[model samples]
Target: MVCVFAIALLLLGPNPAKAESREQAVDRLTDYLFYRVNSQLNNRKLQTDDREYIRQWQRLREAIDPRVKSVQEVCLRVSPQEKGWEFTTINGETYEQTYDRLADTIFYSRHPQRTGQPIPTNDKIGISEWSAIRREMFLSNCGL
Candidate 1:
């Protein structure tokens, strides 16, 4: 009975190198993105010059690396509209963006270049553009 229990424990134990499921992996990535973005915004609001937010963002970026392939394949498989606050890849880089109707502002770590006109505020933009900005921000800031 002890031997059987030990075998069962080994079977149930964690595997450090195991790949996470798509949902689990994306969820992890999303949490990291959310935390980093929120912290940066909050710090900005407080008028603090803290750089701790950058460290948090880096941690999230590292977490997403292992799950990139899975995330890319899943993104291709799903409809764009159906993808919510999850990690998706563009140009072989992983990024986190949400598409909920209630989201008022989109956050990006990196600012994009514009040709002539200034970039419109989040409330005035389309979803596609917003998502593209999010990806660009992730790539620029998260070191992806």
Candidate 2:
């Protein structure tokens, strides 16, 4: 009985691995927003006016803003894939944006790049602008 209790205590002991801090969480949320915005833009088969795009951007901003304080200082890394893009923030969080051009569907996954580097490709997409827009939305919604 004592041996079983000792083993359980060892299993329940505080994990040595450090959990992600709050700043890391904020960065992750920012990266996710960026990927989502890019995917949405790429998958809109019908040409959307600036106003409609802005509305969509606002919705995404609202969805992620509450979880983070500031987006301006967020550092982003973007890599274009065959069908879309993948993004990561300086805090080590990552996400992917895949656009189904045929079906006009946008798929987003948080931390899709956690296990490996993004696939190599030469496809160029408007990554900087998307990152900027994400930062702006985050700042506006979070008052930062």
Give the residue spans of candidate 2 off by over 4 A. 12-19, 38-144
Candidate 2: worst 10 consecutive residues by lDDT? 98-107
Candidate 1: regions farther than 4 A off: 1-18, 40-136, 139-144
Clashing pairs in 2: none
lDDT of 2 by residue, 14-108 (tens): 77665555555544554454445555556444344665444444444444444343233333332232121112222333322211110111111
Model 1: ten consecutive residues of lowest lDDT = 97-106
- Compute the lDDT for candidate 2: 0.38
How accurate locally is residue 60 in candidate 1, as Cα lDDT from 0 to 100? 45
Question: Positional deviation of 97 in candidate 1, in angstroms?
Answer: 12
lDDT of model 1 at position 111: 26
> Candidate 1 residues 54-131, lDDT tens each?
543444455454444432345445554442333444445423322221012333323223323345666455445545
lDDT of each: 0.44, 0.38
What are the models' TM-scores? 0.28, 0.23
